[model samples]
Target: MSNIIETKVCSEIGDIEGVILHTPGSEVENMTPGNAERALYSDILNLSVAEQEYKQLKQVLNKITKTFEVKDLLTEILEINEVKESLVNNICKSENVKPIKSSLLSLESGELARQLIEGVPLNKTTLTGFLSDERNALRPLHNFFFTRDASMSVYDHVLIGKMANKVRERESMVMEAIFNHSSKIKSKTLNPSSSKHHKDEITIEGGDVLVAREDILVIGTGLRTTTQGIDFIIKKIKKNKGKHSIVVQQLPSKPESFIHLDMVFTLLDRDKCMVYDPIIMQPNKYQTILISIDNGKVKKIEKQSNLVDCLRDLGMPLEPVYCGGKKDIWIQEREQWHSGANFFAVGPGKVIGYARNVYTLEEMNSNGFEIIDAQSVVDGKIQLSDYEKYVIAINGSELARGGGGARCMTMPIRRKKVDW
Candidate 1:
């Protein structure tokens, strides 16, 4: 096989080639009651629980794909002269830690890497530094564990996210550098803020965008991605000569659980999907609009019944599998809040998700899926590839509290094309 990795993700369900993941660090543990919400966490995760849960995910993924750690990728890319200098300068300036740039540059590669994600401690010598309660001169990227938000892969190109929150902006910048400058792969990078067609109002996050097929895309709009963001995607799709379509679904903003499209809906197979019943099945004022692009032009834009209905009309039909086992609405709501619908597909009929959502797992098991544990799969007690289709549920108690699941944590860069 060639050493150069190519970006070839064409479907949500495909044999995996490479995936991006970030190992949780002290940065995750650095959260306190004072800045928990600001750090994108309602409660700080117990590090031990998060790490154990994460190990299961890592081991399972390692068995299947060429897994890459974010810190290692960032460190490798930062070793380049121009890239290293520019990234540090930009990061320091943006976070207003210019005074520490020289000190930061002096650190060895290993130490520097840890500091970037875990954060740099305040000097505490100067009056301002002494009184500053902020542990980091540059704040920790507490949400870096959720690698999907910083960058996304679309066909052979990478879309560098423009975060709605400034705290996560550097995560985007770091991801952009890894995709653009790292020796890992070759792919074009698109920055929404600096794109020639970028709009002043456009705000997109990778968490909201789901790649269904080579020509079809499903996006959720709520807190992270907006109408302008969807329009921004439309402009990109309109430039392509081949067949392409964009399905935009508006998401609710109140309850934080409705953060991304995947939070409420995600693909389980070519013909099946996991969904939060209330938001997706039980219709509300939220709209599901489909935009058709015909030969680089806006051909049609119309409302559809729901996301499942829209995808079915477009010929990618998927039967809806409700989160929380399809029983009480209360059970559905409770589990949905914990990312019950969020699962990542490794291939058609083969997927992975959190095992804590027992109700959700029960639904999948009843639907002809052989449920397996992550450790079982990793230890060879269970074989994922042996079964044509299976749901591999991994434990994520503390990690789930971070408000994500398998789909939210993984950034799949490439997958074998489906027979479809």
Candidate 2:
């Protein structure tokens, strides 16, 4: 067994110690055009191409810090007979596939892990099964590669995401099981379902939550995350005795690109942030609210002029870098649609993003960010430590179509404390 990795993430740009990643697999290709919408995808992905693109991301991270694959972690915990039976039973009951419980339990740990993720083929022996159009008894988790959505590390605890869509709920279940039962991980899980304040309407995803500082959080609420979900987090903070602030940004319900805050806004450095102008800077009807908590009680809640200004008042002032160049709105919209603003910070002033956003890359360059190709770093042609501030650009021609960027693909498990 590997050494236990405790969950500790207090800031977005802290030096990463360990992170969780899921490489694109058969599950991503399992979707067809017929069920693409149901799987939360606008289009189907080419597994081969996606795999090639994902390799750049995986390799780059592997070189920088310890990385754990979801399948490997899940498989390790499944080797424990009790954990396996319990997880299988919970999944079967949740998905209403109890009939397959015994069958699932019979498989070896490795095979069982694969089947759990790749999906279980349906048996046509029954009349209903033969007549059904469904291809699998339990549907494949197409969005599993976006590992940031299911669960997130908050300080010393893991917050199990309550997925907005029913189809993605199993992803959360699998993640919760891994965190709760894995002997190789040390952390308590905070599940909304188990909370006394839990409600059916509460839904939160990892992509919507960003740890700005040890005492501050930035959360987005829209299609994927609800207001009630933010309230749940507020309640959790109320239990802790300290000053805490949550910056809530209301998001657009349409144009799927705005599904999460990270898609339109992400921290680039201690004093810099990437943003899509239309939604974040040139704001419209969307509102930014600041909620402050002190000594286990609600101190104040009020509307803010903008996110940047709000954070500035709270002491963390940041300069905004437009997603595309400042010249054209058309270019900004185009690149932002493909996740131009989504950059994952490995450390302060050090990040990763898509190289396809030429305009966005140009903007970053103008703002003193040295752009480097991901392959160069992976192949040892270039050393990342040589640059104090650089954005490692990965080829995202195919991966971006899945509706996320570098931040959407990573879930930080442990990070070194920032000397602020």
Candidate 3:
């Protein structure tokens, strides 16, 4: 077995050292059009095409850093009898599938892991089961491929998600179990569910939180994350007793595209950021608030002029790259819907995003970022180190339909601290 993996994430633009990924599997294809909305998907994905597209991301990440698969890690820990029993018990109880406990415990670790994620089919032998319209005794995790949503690593601790949707609650439970029991992972887990201040409305998803720097956290509050959720995060920081800053951007509730902070804004480097102009830059009903915490207390709380201005005031001046381009608002709206602003930084000035956003890529090119195809890097035709600043564009035609981009799909566990 590999040595226990300690978690650490101090910056968004640092060189990634370790990351967790879940390749699209049957769990993704398990959903039907009827349940797509509940699954939080705008459209159903073609499994074959999605897998092909995902391979580009997986292969690119594999070449760059140490990558771990959730299933493999889950199976590794499930091999421990005590951990296995406790995890299964917790899952069955939390998910209201206690009837399957003995059966789950009876299976081998590998098979059990598969069933847990892909779902266990309902027997339908009993009268209640036969009469019920349910398809599985346990629901398949349809959105597991977007690993960034369930749990997030922030400066050595894993924050287990308190999901906004009941359907995704199991994903958090599964992730918490992995971080808690996986022999390969060594990290303290903070679960809002266990928090004394937690309430039904206090839900926070990983997609809404960004570790911009060791002492700075940029968060979004909207449909997915509530004020109470942000409050829980504030309490956590206060307990730590240090100078901490958080820039809270209020997101729109109407468009499903504005689901998280990363959807509209993401840090690309120590001095660069990508933003959708309408909400982030332009004056709107949604406000940006900055809160400063020092010496275990909130030193100041006030409304900020805007996300960009507030960030600059925090001493992290960033040059903004418009999502689609600076010319047209129409194109910006279209491309932002397709996740044009969502870029995942593997290192400062080194990132990955979709190539479909031609105008956005052009803007990046104008900003001196070399555009490289992910396939070229994967095939060894071009070395990534050859370019100091580059964007490896992956084909996200199919994956983008899943309503996320490179940043939304990744959950970076450990990153080398940036020399700011």
Candidate 4:
């Protein structure tokens, strides 16, 4: 039998070979307007509509490459008694629900996996449980569908997320468990929790880190990721002897839409990138800095003009496609808030994003990208291979309200090398 999982992601625009996805479950419906903000959601999503839109992306990916579902992977890992006990213990400890450890241990792998993600209902038999205001022993992972945040695959290793929010920390724990213990995967996970360098102030998420090339990384620091987190990544890169570069873009702390780098900047192709000009290109108080590592030691750290200019100076010049079009900043800000800038590359020049951003799609069409509806591709009405570069537009009116796009919902593990 062949190994199903081999981690290798050197570039954002490589030909994707294997990726992980988590179809939104009842966990999404498990939220209420009262606590949605605490869950990092501005608004509760219509799970039915979101699932329909997600299916198109899922079907297209399934047809193009190998795809794994989180629930399935978790189920497989739980079959091993030792792994099951260990994961349950870690979760119980992290959430301060040690009393539920024995209860969770008794569940079979399948049910346990479901409860872990969807949430374990509180047992009202006990006096404390009955009197408690909490509705669950384990709160639902409301943001798990945006799988990109919990764990990141970077050059043969997985960097488990150190979530900025306590509510989402379990997301990282579950992802780390899946990658570390799943028989289907074949790579080691590097968790900040295990590092002596780990500190409560350090925070990193997949959305803020992008592998521009094998030796170059683009990271964002703001509400979701901290400067300390970038320092941790630099230390990790120093362990390997090579010339490496990390471009750090400081983001605004307000407007939750600017939560991560991917929210405003994402690679669309080897020579093309999607960007929100206000943050990535235009002059602003936020600074863009570059750190260079040579032979396992930092050689220099200096400020750069902007993200686009910095990349150009680094030898990979990308044609900027403004999100929500360049005609007006008001339109750009509006669509940017709705996740118009987020795009996920399936191949060198092929990508996927929300179709609701009409201005952005028009810009893509004007710039040599053929627009193809995701539903048509899923229904066999069109063939993706016919176009050399095209954008698979998925319906996301409801999903975008959840604060992410295709890139946020999927985590790529393996990709064919990009020929630049």
- Per-candidate clashes, comma-separated: 0, 0, 0, 0
Candidate 3: the clashing residue pairs are none
lDDT of 4 by residue, 4-49 (tens): 6788899999999999999998999988888898888999899999
Tens digits of per-residue lDDT for model 2, 43-106: 8888899999998899999989999999999999899998999899989999999999999999
For candidate 4, report its TM-score: 0.98
Q: Write the per-residue lDDT of candidate 1 for residues 151-218, one digit (tens) a residue.
A: 89887788888888989988998898888887887778888888565456778998899989989999
Residue-level error in angstroms, candidate 2, position 381: 0.6
What is each predicted model's overall lDDT from 0 to 1? 0.87, 0.92, 0.91, 0.92
Worst 10 contiguous positions by lDDT, candidate 4: 192-201
Q: Clash pairs of candidate 4?
A: none
Off by over 4 Å in 2: none
Model 3 CA lDDT for position 100: 93
lDDT of 2 at 314: 96
**Which pairs of residues clash in candidate 2, taking residues 3 or more apart in a chain or in different chains?**
none
Ranked by lDDT from best down, the candidates are 2, 4, 3, 1
Per-residue error at 117 for model 2, in Å?
0.7
| Alpha-carbon lDDT of model 2 | 0.92
**Candidate 3 vs candidate 4, TM-score winner:** 4
